[model samples]
Target: MFAKTQAAAPVEAPKATGPAIVPGVIDFNVPGCKPEYPRASLRNEETGTVVLSVLIGADGSVADVKIDKSSGFRGLDNAVRTQLMSGACKNKPGTVDGKPQQTWTKVQYVWKLD
Candidate 1:
């Protein structure tokens, strides 16, 4: 006699609310300030962009800083961190449903010759 096989339940895919945007990149705003590092010290005279990974708290302030992409110069990297930590950059805290949340943000700093 063949044993009765149980029917499998249908699987449902997870529903997506909408377009998912990275918290950091979604609400990123650059601060206005002159380049702290002199142009003479830059390794490249041409424009350079430094992308940094920064941890922002619910307070909308930089909590941590790490160089995701270096501009090939130590000075430039340090300057970027300095500006961020200085609170010159005003960032809107990330939120899922109108509630502020801590998130890691990727910010780019463009360094150009003056």
Candidate 2:
């Protein structure tokens, strides 16, 4: 039998280039994430903004959401958490090397009486 030929050289795999980049504060629009008015808060005439620390997954999904600052009303704070976890807050995640990545962002829910 003939001698075995040498193996082929190893080929490097292509790197993952993250999402496109835009200069100067690109508009990262939140698809459809609006906090609804909390029934309890509305009934009590509560008005304030709840700041939330949200973690978005690479696939534009909500990974985690927590209250960074309360709206001075426990009901409002709870409502914010509820709203976020209720699948209302979602946006395109940041990217690195053309690959999607998890990103942290802040979202404020303003509760005002009509």
Candidate 3:
């Protein structure tokens, strides 16, 4: 099971003033999905923000994930990757011209110990 990230907000492209850009409207806020801290990481008190560059397909599935930044712990990094690959961070794909289109987006997972 996974817990929801406190801030699931997305970093979307800027709005259109004139004509829309290749990077159209994107809803970075993907609710209901969050990365979970693995027990190993928790036991070791590992915490940091894992920045991810994700490629979302037209169907809203996570097609690929690249670690833009890591938490510096092997366990944490693996856990974050696993969580995302396992569909814990899936979201609705961004759209262009009122149609679902593949898009590149950034997601950050801040792991904290409580």
Candidate 4:
């Protein structure tokens, strides 16, 4: 009598660990590219944190910026928006599969005066 042989199980590929996709971020370490506290806001003593939804392109450019949470001061919010859109600083694009990809991320700015 012949003995029956069993087939080996198939091996599965290793899954990705940790975060699947990296979130985009705004880099303010560029020369002449720093967040400026709105002068009007400072004069008015308005201080608050602004939360923005920024869409950064794969090319590290600001595609779109929308205010998720306002700082209760239009001037302050607009200032941050303008600075980000000016291309003065670099925006780190999100990545997937180790490749740059257009992704939206949350950005926060505080409008405070010393």
Best by lDDT: 4
Query: For model 1, how does the per-residue alpha-carbon lDDT over 1-114 read when each residue is reduced to its tens digit?
Result: 999999999999899897343464323345443347656565456456788888877777777889999987777778878877777666777665666777887778887776
List, in order, the clash count of every candidate structure.
Answer: 0, 6, 1, 0
Error of 1 at 62 (Å): 0.6
Residue 17 lDDT, candidate 1, scale 0-100 = 92
lDDT of each: 0.70, 0.69, 0.69, 0.83
Please give, for residues 78-111, the per-residue lDDT of candidate 4 as tens digits: 9889988888768678998679999899988877
For 1-114, candidate 3 gives per-residue lDDT tens digits of 998779768999998676332322223345535556788877888888878787777777777778988878878777766766665455667776667788877877778887
Writing each residue's lDDT as its tens digit, candidate 2 over 4-81 gives 899999999999886563211112245446566778778889899888877777776777778988889998888667
Candidate 2 Cα misplacement greater than 4 A, ranges: 1-32
State residue 79's C-alpha deviation in candidate 1, in Å: 0.3
Candidate 1 local Cα displacement, residue 93, angstroms = 1.0
Per-prediction TM-score: 0.65, 0.65, 0.68, 0.76
lDDT, residue 15, candidate 2: 98
Looking at model 1, residue 90 earns an lDDT score of 61
> Candidate 2: global Cα-lDDT?
0.69
